[model samples]
Target: MLLSCGQPLPLLRHTDVPPRVVENFILTGYRFPNYSLRECLLSAFRPTNETGNFWTHFLPFFIFLYYFVEVFGWEGAPHGDAQFFYPLWNYFIGVFCLLMASSMAHLLNSMSLVVREVCFFVDYGTISSYTVGSSLAYYYYIHPRAGTVETGGRNDSHMDLKPEHAGSLTSSYAILDFSVFFETFYIPSACVVAIICVLSCCNTRQRWRRHRYLIRTFVFLLPFLVSSTPIFYRLLTRSPYLSASSSFAASTSMSSFFYRHCLWLLMSAVFNISKFPERLAPGRFDIWGHSHQWFHCCTFLSILDELHMIKTEVRAILLSPTLLLPPAVLSRLPGPTVASTYGVMFLLQTTIISIIVWFSWHANSIHGPERDQLAKDHPKKPLKCH
Candidate 1:
């Protein structure tokens, strides 16, 4: 049967037309009969083409969520236990938001230049939020705050504070400290994001004038003012109370070092720039073992390592009371000393070793057909026509 437009109602198929053309037809307010609807729906829900994009972006969120919940529910006390949990939770949430934003941007970006521009802004916003959130989390947990005090067999109003909180009121002050810290990193990052967005969106002539102005104003100025002042003041003050050295401090420092400096920065840079393997053989590594995929793997590994460190530290703190002491040490140690010292070390080592083994095995076993498919699908010059 033919529709009102003289088009066959039962013969339409996406195979007969490019996906772009179909998208355009729909965007331009065209309608089709049963065959067209079937084709459109099939194209929209196609498993093969979009699965990688969906899973790659969303999987990180789920994985992080699981870890966050598990860690939060863990019982027992460690150094900075409450502090560690809160910041890490914020960091994970920030990362999850970033992944979601990035996924959306990548998925819809190729639809049109306008769509690309919008998505780019969204992606930048997500990244900024992530940075801010992570820094804030760190600041909150590291800084000192008010604790409860008991007097005369009852809770009293007299202020009780840790060394870190000396001359301050509570952990709430950390909010301001974090705000400044966030601004420091975020301003420059925001500028970079803005420049990228403008250059991506604007034509050559328009970019020179209009985009530059926007970049200098919104991206440069705002971030500069917000991030710089507070960071400068904090640095100048040399406040020992800002961040204390606890077991949690050691664990978080190690984790952050791996994630922020080694994993996230290094991996993201390599993937974005497509250096090394990608440069040597562009299309060859596209499908399964591309630079991007490797980057993802590295990121996951980094996060896992961080989580392990946290877990180890927590376990160590909780098990401190049960560990045995060496003969020489036990003779000099107080009753609680032996268990706490040995327990901490044992838990730390166990967590670190277990995480290392799991990741190493998983990494080794990843070679398969998926890698081959990626190479085949993503040739070096995938965008040569454009």
Candidate 2:
């Protein structure tokens, strides 16, 4: 019979007892460890190999959640239309879910190879869900048509009309426009699909040979083709509702710029080949400042940058005279003022971004035993640039 000897495990000192135990003790589920209260509280917050990963992602989610609730919970606050509100809420929910999934994945992935596989799959799924949700939110509310209400012999449009339309005889018209369908849906979908497909391709060996070529082709061609959709649709339909420069159009333009400039293309190549810094440093980055984490941060920053540009364009459109219909059409709308709504949104964004930055800084500062283990594993590799 084969004999197995388990390696000696570290004992839990009173001062270094797991936070979970401390939490349980507070809940009366377990007796308190023989440690000072101050020490217990500090230890509870201190980063451990397992808890550090969870908290890193979890902190961002909590920050976002705080702002999300503040931004969306006020029933009478003036900022956005009902059409915009629901989609925005959904988008925030997706983000929350993604953050939770990421936190869980990071926490459990190192438990074992099997757990790592499961966590990775869950993380990828959450990412896909978030991408789809965000794209859908953008698509759903780009231009919403409001219903007319009869109020005291007046026709009230759902949106506020411009001041110049006060004396207009005709009822202000709000058209159900689907002018930039391609830019709103197709381009974003293409980009997201290309990203997910490439990421997935990295793992599957059986489909790798055939899917690799298909993915590459799609990633190269789809954005341009999809972006042309809005232009073609506008030309073919002669729709006045379609802006010559819509948010979707702007995002597609940025995607095109990135593609042509070879940033995404190079990143895609790097991802597919798994070469250079990643390959050379493999387990070296299994902990802090890994290439994968860098990749995630870069992808998030790029998307946010594009979305911010699109949002700025949207704000400009909202403020444009041409987009505003006549008033008498605006009196029936139930909402806060645009300025107030956007102001709250701006505040929320600022707070959340600040918190995320702080959390990231805090996470970066903590050096755990796992990091030391990684260093021991790859002592000769060049230090990773954060």
**Tens-digit lDDT track of model 1 for 1-386:** 22345433232233443232232111221112112223333422333222344456667777766766675455554333333344455556557767787666545543333333445455555554454444333332322111211111211111234445443523333334443334245334433443333333232212344343234224423432342333333333332222432332433343343334344544544554443464566444433344444555555555555445445444433333222111122122222222232342234334434433443344324422333443455332312221
Tell me the RMSD of model 1 versus the true structure.
Answer: 17.9
Candidate 1: clashing residue pairs, number: 9
TM-score of each: 0.43, 0.43
Error of 1 at 187 (Å): 11
- Give every collision pair in model 1: 183-227, 184-227, 283-379, 283-380, 286-374, 287-374, 287-375, 288-374, 320-340
Minimal lDDT window, size 10, model 1: 146-155
Per-candidate RMSD, Å: 17.9, 15.6
Instruction: Show how many residue pairs clash in every candidate, following the order shown.
Output: 9, 3
